[model samples]
Target: MHFQVWLQSIQANGRLKVPESEDVWSLLPSFPLSSFSLSSLSLSSPYLLGIGALASLTVYWLVTRPRPMRPPCDLQAQSVAVEGNPSCRRSALLKDDALLEFYYEDTRTVYDIFKRGLRIAGSGPCLGFRKPGQPYQWIPYTEVAAQAQMLGSGLLAKGCQPNPEQFVGIFAQNRPEWVIAELACYTYSMAVVPLYDTLGLEAMVHIFNLAEISLVFCDREEKASSLMDNKVKGAVPTLSCLVLFGDFSGDLLERGKECGVEVLKLQELMDLGRQNLKDPVPPQPQDLAVVCFTSGTTGKPKGAMITHGNIASNTSSVIKILEGSFVIQQEDVSISYLPLAHMFERMIQVSMFCHGARVGFYQGDISLLMDDIKTLKPTFFPVVPRILNRIYDKILGSVTSPLRRTLLHYAVRRKQAELSSGVVRNNSLWDKLVFNRIQASLGGNLRFILTASAPISPVVLSFLRATLGCLIFEGYGQTECTAGCTFSMPGDWTAGHVGAPLPCTVVKLVDIPEMNYYAKNGEGEICIRGHSVFRGYLRDAERTAEALDSDGWLHSGDVGQWLPNGTLRIIDRKKHIFKLSQGEYIAPEKIENIYMRCFPILQVFVHGDSLQSYLIGIVVPDPEVFADWAKERGFVGSLEELCQNPDVKKAVLEDMRAVGKEAGLKSFEQVRDLYLHPEMFSVANGLLTPTLKSRRVDIRRVFQEQISSMYSKSAP
Candidate 1:
């Protein structure tokens, strides 16, 4: 691991991203590298250890940047402080170009990957599901593939065409049947348009007609009946057929006939397909594989047209990137609980399938997810930030006394020290004595956990890494890029930043001058261009044009800053940021994320306008947390009654302010006025989308009077 050998290794094995440390600060978090001693450098740390050439480069980088101490690499919260004018625009590509499709076979389509699995591990346990009181029953890869073929034939037998233009709808929860139905559609060169509960009746009607869905498969009779009702009312005129999984009463068929739609049982459809078997009509790379409708924060959900190439490319990129680090193996098992309708879960599933890994479905109850996890005992765990946050809160909340706190902190520090040195095993006394329960809760076999769909807090990320002793990879992506654009790598202990771009995509940052973000300063709007990028939104050219530039670059609305370690930190969203009257721009989402850590609040919406000088927030408090706070302070009221209490509101606002200050938010960034809403911002309330993201426009319109009142009262 010496310098020249590392230099030879870098030239041979890695494409070293030489940091322009001329303007950026040091690599270490504690102090400036200018004051750092070279003797302290580890020769085998994989940061091209301190040898002659690397040492000279490090010396040049540290000495050239005589800047003040930049903010810590692990951003505490809304801290994105810069100290110097950077000298160059920045972009990051793969550490090695040969990795883009290295582990991946020449799979041009999604079905090709499935076939590869069929060749490699045909007899292996593939999809597994569980009954209420029974163990998981697995369907072998060969059997599952045969079932998909039969179902695809069944789709054709029931007047469903194999044209890519004609989409078959899948409206069901995540299950074996949901996947089989999707794969069936792929088998016939057809596409699937997923229908979810969050879409609402109006949105469902829109999707049914927008995709001109003639036949749909659902798991429940209730969903089938509701969809039939829409068809009967002529709201969804093109919807003529309904397929329900499992058993159903004959009366449903009578109702379907009355509604002019045919209802077929899952077994009945399979029998029909078996009787009328046909050859597979595989799709080309450019053919539409799915029309994934995104649950957006505003307006009707837009359908993102994902091609076979889009999915295959993204899957290949992910597999290749994870090859040497945290590779998915044939023995690996993962529990499928996240929304399968979303590209994020679908991408993960495909990766698992490609490696012949086992995927088990949850029992469909959030409360029993842990029970299901223990039952399945998955080797690989995939999650979101919210899931990790709950684990962090629950673990910390259990420490009731000073002694326990001290012991916990000491254990965490010890584990964290070992973790920084690349040790991630449950071999320590602390792991056996204290963290075993935490690990056991997740079935105790997790080697790695991959989190995406949101940025995880550095504290929570670090805490989970220390306690669980698992390599937790933080990924940043959206549906637009087929779920993953940048994923953190192994051995990178630094937090608050997503890792470098995948070899499938080239990530670049362009200056967003209006927001004071410059690429030369290592800050700007992130733009991605590569095979993994999705095709434009289905039939929505205007938005597609807005997202994809004249060049191939897909302009991510997210603002990113390149870290000294050549990683990207998502700092803000350009579309969501608003400016105050005094000209300081406010990123409401960034502030909201920080404020969400406040105990009393369950959900928060920070609003700022150019006409206003200060910010206002509408928070939906956690009833339990509020009750605890009220009881401790001799206050008396239900959540509704407390919302009207000036004292309660004042206390909540003060708590928010304190949390914001701790997160290092500036005065303007802090909410000056607060409204405690008794009601939750749920999907039913029109404030949240099905995905639980706040619908800002609807929330604003619904609480316009309250917003106006808050601003008026706070006015000078």
Candidate 2:
């Protein structure tokens, strides 16, 4: 018999009989027990009838039935979505008047852009950091949005009312929990105040006192426990809640309870929201969304009250400048590794979401960035100078053999030649042989990179561009201006200069007295005015009035000048300029730039004024570069010896002189003295700010004795 007819003959009721051959069973259609019952009953045996009747009943019961019901609602059902928001659209995010006229004439609402991100990143792989010691896990955005809503509802259910200006503190690192907390606040119309994770106990107390944070979402047990174990002198006395993101099997919760605080895990909070609440009220565009802290480089740190309008406006500006620069589309991916407390990464996050790009957070240990990047293969990246320097160090480290070294040098020259000839694509055999490996080491699909914070070395910039066969767009901005001010265009790039101001920005150069290195006529401190300019520092009217003057021009405190072609070259910080005893004004950044080119150090901060005719610097040595140097020289001991050795200092000083001669700098401006520290100066050490800018006051105070001893001869 044919396979279909044979299978029908064996059908016992609504199910098929066991076939003798596996292959034959695969080819047969599903069997019905009713057919089998009819066939068997006609087959002349009462014994056969009994077996067939039992099989038919079993098939009928199994095929169509419902399981027992337990409760009125499933706990999992709280994560459901009520779709179709008319207020949220991608077009509403674009608010720059000039940019709207130029590119993106259509506008998108904040909610619309967020929903688009939801649609674009739907069910895709995304990694996020929760805290230290905890593994960074991957989850879909659809799940993240659901969890965020549930958490928002939970906050409302816990007697936390979301007023238009209600402030909640997000005191954590660049983790997925931080993002969720911020989004949850937006859903509930509560403004999130992002505090730096590296802040000390004093700064934390001060900020809590100022912002009046009733509740805080922190990353680990340490931060949460610290807040609860002790009484802060001037902190928010009514602060009663601490929600930890990860495993809190320590004394943190008990300590919190002792201080009249309620401690809970992030998961517990979300479960509560899901169980008690149905839906959350989303924030409007005009709502006070976030309060970002400005870098206190010149004075005390102040909260910059940012509305949704501000965020939407800045993200729109970013979209305008980056429209055709790179190939990021709705399908591309980006990796965010920088701290979210800073405005730079936060703005990039919003922009990436609006662009319908998937974002993956880097593993907490940034030393493993290469592994993470290789895994994610992001198309969009924004990195600081320190990261780029490491990349340069890695590439140079691979050149060991003579033949390999020569081949690498030859490839670089050829790549530069192709770039000069307007051939940016790496389509040649030599490029494949040499540069392709280099690109692969950076996860291979890197289309564009944005570098900011501290200035990047030109060699690093050129090497990245030629090797990646992609663009590296350099941008300049500050927290006061909400992250981005001006960026280099794809076709218009000039090294050492951070391109022209943005389309909406009006930049003017106010000529000051001639400095040692700045141009006598053309250069001056750069002043900017635009919509992106912040309202004022929160609650400090005097300082705010000083920063934003009578004419609405925000004094950027950065010295720069516009070239005849309209390109702006930032010289240095205005506060960094100091006059020597001989009355020669010197910009320390100019001296440091020359010194960095001379030494293999990560950074050089120059300081000298009243005492000496020249400059001195506190140098932070690169560990990898020095380690290889020590290995090559047969020197042994520790990394500290390599940094603080007199021989290393002499060699570095010789290179400094050579660099001074090459740059044609005056003798007085050359670095006359240097003190090498074994430790790296970072934001964690209170030396550098979160954005990588040098905290001049703190650094100067820390190295005062060393600096005084170095310049004692000239003090008289």
Best by lDDT: 1
lDDT of 1 by residue, 223-324 (tens): 898887887788999888888897778878898888788888888898899999989999988898999998866677789888888888888866655565
Model 1 off-target regions past 4 Å?
A: 1-102, 581-583, 622-645, 678-680, 683-686, 701-705
- Misplaced by over 4 Å in model 2 are 1-112, 123-137, 230-234, 276-280, 284-286, 295-299, 325-327, 514-521, 627-639, 642-647, 713-716
Q: Highest TM-score, which number?
A: 1
Give candidate 2's total backbone clashes. Answer: 17
The window of 10 residues in a row where model 2 has the poorest summed lDDT is 73-82
lDDT tens digits, residue span 17-39, model 2: 54455343333344443366454
CA RMSD per model (angstroms):
11.8, 18.0
